[model samples]
Target: MRFTFTCHATDGHARTGVLSTPRGDIRTPAFMPVGTAATVKAMSIDQVKSTGADILLGNTYHLMLRPGGERLARLGGLHHFMGWDKPILTDSGGFQVWSLAGLRKMTEAGVEFRSHIDGSRHMLTPERSIELQADLIGSDIIMQLDECTTFGSSHEEALVSLELSARWGERSKVAFGGTRATQALFGIVQGSVFPDLRKRSADALKSIGFDGYAIGGLAVGEGHQLMCQTLDVTVPELPMDRPRYLMGVGKPIDLVEAVHRGVDMFDCVLPTRAGRHGQAWTWDGPINIRNARFAEDPDPIDPTSTCPASSRPSKAYLHHLFKAEEILGQTLLSWHNLGFYQDLMAAMRAAIAKGQFQDLRARLRQRWGFAPLD
Candidate 1:
């Protein structure tokens, strides 16, 4: 199927919909598990699929460095190479390259940086990024190469970054070329914390046109309130017909709030990363399985979850595994966390459909330790 988004229900700013792609339909507001190296850390492809996730987010920076994108295409693209038949979204390697800080140099052409893996030099321009994600990886959804403006930037600093990103967005669209039919290219809006610049960036992307629009440059030390305020100014500037994606945001509370602000898709590594460190996210809130109180607790992470990793293993067993430094602890918690995220998304969709999203949000915020909206 060609890429399309149809909004089926709405409650205030929150809406529920389906993103139709050739591989499958992704339900909104969707949370994609981060598969940084073609894997969701400790979880198997089957386990990731079992979590009700309709799509997975792949990292272009890491993939291009390790196995190389050309090799992946020669082996039949990422889907076949990774054993996942579902829709996949690949980010432009911009953020990863930007994070290199002292290791990278940014120019009008693109970013030049040394690989963290082997200290080898590489250049990633908008065209090259598109070629890797769209043609080489065969990703269903591809993001444009945009400079990720860091938080605490002055208006002058942000304007410079925003203009450069707009230029890159145009180049990325051009590089996409004939692949438009099978792949969806998304333009990312980057303006740091400035509302005016955010609006300008969104307008620029709309002029270039895209299958979707992504809100980037937030969740980088800017608090939750600031992120939502930025979204308030940015999301409305986007086309209502296409999908709105929030990049690198996966906190449970953040997901709920972003959906309320009208974002349809999100991806982050928090779930799996936290799992590896013994954090378990539940409906009530996040709990550390390593807490001494759980040493003898007989309850599973969630007795109601259909996922075996969530419902079958008791908290005591999980705690013991972590204490013993066993690998199974990471696998089980990772499985449970992804499952919990999917469950949260499903609940959001259901609540929106019933025009009770606000009620659900209120309950979640309170449970997750956030004060009520003033």
Candidate 2:
């Protein structure tokens, strides 16, 4: 609500800023944990908070289906419904409509598709998406409903999609109106991988205007280099005063790379999803808890990590939990990964503030055994 972004420091294209909202101040470059369906999977609200996350992302598509958005409203919004009082950002359900819907129809108005869950029919127009996020979910940061295109679409296909998305963005702004009341509406730029189309989309969004801007339509199988390259062209076109969010993005390396390219906000399911399968993300690298070499490893996941899962519990015990198929394995690993991600963001923020982001990034790449992406 009433989001304000103040750039505190800048190192190359990377900058550190704070996103002030009604719920709280989100430190950038922040990593928002994905809490689709009102929950962050294996972790409790307190556990999630302990990870140092200032905001979380909710899925508008899933909530609109099961449990229903109206139900959440009656229960006093997503914050009260999920018991997390921090800032919440909800996607406009465009990506899910493209990914999860079965039979679909796309038009100038919006998309009509059958739900992947229970075959229910739904219409997701730009106005409807805004209503769902603002009126029902009460999201602090709301995204506009825009068409998402595949990574390798032809230039013509991408141009049509981007134009339609721009129209939808206009509709979304009209639906949002000027009665934000502490809520922020963001416009998404969708142009697949075409630089000219991305510039056009960005210019259109700037013309329409929004509280923030998001880089969309990548990360759908485009490698990190292209994503970074796209940002190279698109990010400079956006307003410097507004926040920049990169939606549905990726691994630890991906986060650092995007931050280097001037992205301010991010959300992904990688950490929790990987943890559920017995993986742990450490400063050294991601390690598999199920590895036979760790069957008797007595060390914790990361002895220096502030998370209890990494500081108190040993790898041997975590390995035992995984081998035994115990639920604690998922819980512990998820906690560690979430805490690690927050720590990563915090470190980057600090580095940027000190004008040492490049130095910090180089150290991280060396420690994580990743060569620079040239």
Instruction: Quantify all predictions' global Cα lDDT against the true fold.
Output: 0.94, 0.92
The deviation in Å at residue 132 for candidate 1 is 0.5
lDDT of 1: 0.94
The Cα error of candidate 2 at residue 97, in Å, is: 0.6
Superposed Cα RMSD, model 1: 0.9
Most TM-score-accurate candidate? 1
- TM-score per prediction, in order, is 0.99, 0.98
lDDT of 1 by residue, 1-374 (tens): 57999999999989999999989899999999999898899989999999999999999999999899999999999999999999999999999999999999999999999999999999999999998998899899999999999899999999999999999999999898854776899999999989899999999989999999999999999998899899999988989999999999968999999999899999999999999999999999999999999999998989999989899999999999999999999999999999999999999999999999999999999888899866
Candidate 2 overall Cα lDDT vs. reference?
Answer: 0.92
* Candidate 2, position 161, lDDT: 93
- Model 2 residue 148 CA deviation (Å) reads 0.8
The reply for model 2, stretches above 4 Å from the true place, is 372-374
